[model samples]
Target: MTDHAREQATILETHGLTKDFKGFTAIKDINLSVQTGSIHALIGPNGAGKTTFFNLLTKFLKPTSGQIIYDGRDITHARPAGIAQRGLIRSFQISAVFPHLSARENVRIALQRKLKVSYHFWRPLRILDQLNEQAQATLEQVGLGKFGDVKAVELPYGQKRALEIATTIALEPRLMLLDEPTQGMSAEDVSTVTDLIKRVIEGRTIVMVEHNLNVVATLADQITVLNRGEILAEGNYDEVSNNPEVMEAYMGTTDAA
Candidate 1:
């Protein structure tokens, strides 16, 4: 790909993005670009406005100023559903699945939603057997093939997270936003989730807010560090990870936290 195509492949871009809640600024003058088919990580301490930034991109919250461009289209004022229709989707840190439903059923519902199938009050979900197959295939892709028959609430926490990823990918988004994707997992679980994330980004762009520095170092092609409501540093892992500003921020937070 030519350099320009490489950049255009950047499925998501933000220029001078700012968000304010009353008089409190949640994100300030942030400029970010995520290359197509690459893993770009957003990292910071708690309450750093990472989630707020996500809300703006996904249209859960409107920006007070600036622009959000996705897939070369201006989406600054697009609604959440409108953005999703344009191939941008986000997964929350909290599981967005039916706790009482089977894993396959959860994914099946997601597929049905993506396809905009009518929700008939009396129609059985089994009527969409083809969708079930597709859901199973997605589960397999996220390493949860065996858990398809299990109830979502019964699976281990990590598997639930994997299921969430499966559901999001089932939407077939060109840009995927993941918020704190590895929260509340053991070391082994974290590694598994990290690998799954890497696998998922093979053909699409991924922008994620990750707390673990190790995960960022392993998967991030580019990194942006947020503090309070503004970007403190932006670069590759080595560049941002070793920057004096990053170290000071971490140190200051550590001392305070």
Candidate 2:
């Protein structure tokens, strides 16, 4: 890609961003810019306001000050639904699937929502074969094809996490915000999820909050370390990883991991 593409490719931008709850600041005067088609990782210790930042970007929470720009448009005050309609979507830190529904059914529901199809109780679900096919394809993309017929809650924890990814990908978002995508996963499961995340960023922008330094090192094209709700450093893996401030903030030591 050209330099212009690299710079102007910023799909998400925040300037002087701040958020406060009852006189307590959650995020302060933060500035962030994410390049298009890049995997940008946000890392910090517990209670560092990472989730609050995700909420702000996805329009779940309004900023007390500053602006949020997506694809050249000012979306600082847009509604969550409007942001999703504009091709920005977020997956929750917690599992957000219907436990009683089949994995395929969960993805199908997401597809229907993306297509804006009205729900009809009178019609049989079999009538939507095309939708089913799309959902299956999404499942395959996330390596959950064989589990499509299983109830979401019955699947293993790792599989359920994969299902969540499938559901998010089905929306075909231009930008995706993932919160703790690999939380509570095994080492093998973490690798699986990491590969899936890389694949999903083929033509989209991704911003995620992860505590796993290894995962961040593996997937993040750029890393932004947050401390006490403010940006401490942002750069490529090597840049941020080698920064003394980041080391001190995260590990409480300047020694390399």
Candidate 3:
């Protein structure tokens, strides 16, 4: 694509983004862009400001300075809830589901947001029941069709993570910010979630922070490497993987994966 076409395809962009604490700068003077239909991976050693960047994008933490443009609008000052309502949704690094709620109920809640009835207690139970079919279908999409009645806390580790993704999918986001979607999973589970991610990614963009280079290789169309809260390199997996600086940042080796 031409430069203009590339610019047109960008769904999210950050300009000079930085965040500072009393004695710490979490991330600094960063400019990044995410294309509308790509899986962009952020990779680096721990404390590379990946989560900080995610917080900034979701408006959970206001940038100390800079602008965040999303889908052609300046949302730098938007609130988290406002941004989510506008279709910029994110999943926490940790699996986030209501432990007490059944898998179907967890997904149902996310679906409720789409119908704008999350807080409609006055509505009859039947009104909420209307979401059950969609919720079950969402569960099936994530390979949890038969586990809909299971409580989230009762699920295995990988299944819990799958439930989280299922709920995220129910929201129908335009961009999905997945923070370590495969963290702490067994090798078998990693493959499962990786495949699940591919299946669910038809109409939306995904920006993921992942440590598994193999997963990044299989899933990422673009890669950005960060070191000491600054961008160290940007390219596809092979490009970043072969950079001496990127290798050095990963403790002087490319095997940091």
Measured by lDDT, the strongest candidate is 3
lDDT of 1 at 49: 89
The digit string of per-residue lDDT tens for model 1 on 1-257 reads 89887767777889999998889988999998888888999998788889999999999898999999888889999889898888898999998889999999888887876555746747765676779889999999999999899999998999999999998988888889999999888999999999999898878888999999899999999999999989999999989877877877888633322
User: Where is model 2 poorest over a 10-residue stretch in terms of lDDT?
Assistant: 113-122
- After the best TM-score superposition of candidate 2, give how far the Cα of residue 141 lies from its true spot, in angstroms: 1.0
Model 3 lDDT-worst window of ten? 248-257
Steric clash pairs (candidate 3)? none
On TM-score, who's better, 1 or 3? Answer: 3
Best-fitting candidate, measured by TM-score? Answer: 3
lDDT of each: 0.88, 0.88, 0.93
Given candidate 1, what's the lDDT at residue 131?
Answer: 91
Question: Per-residue lDDT for 116 in model 3?
Answer: 79
Question: Can you write out model 3's per-residue Cα lDDT over 24-97, one digit (the tens) per residue?
Answer: 99999999999998999999998899999999999889899989999988999999998898889998878899
**Winner by lDDT between candidate 3 and candidate 1:** 3
RMSD of each: 2.4, 2.0, 1.8
With a 3 Å backbone cut-off (N, CA, C), the pairs that clash in candidate 2 are none
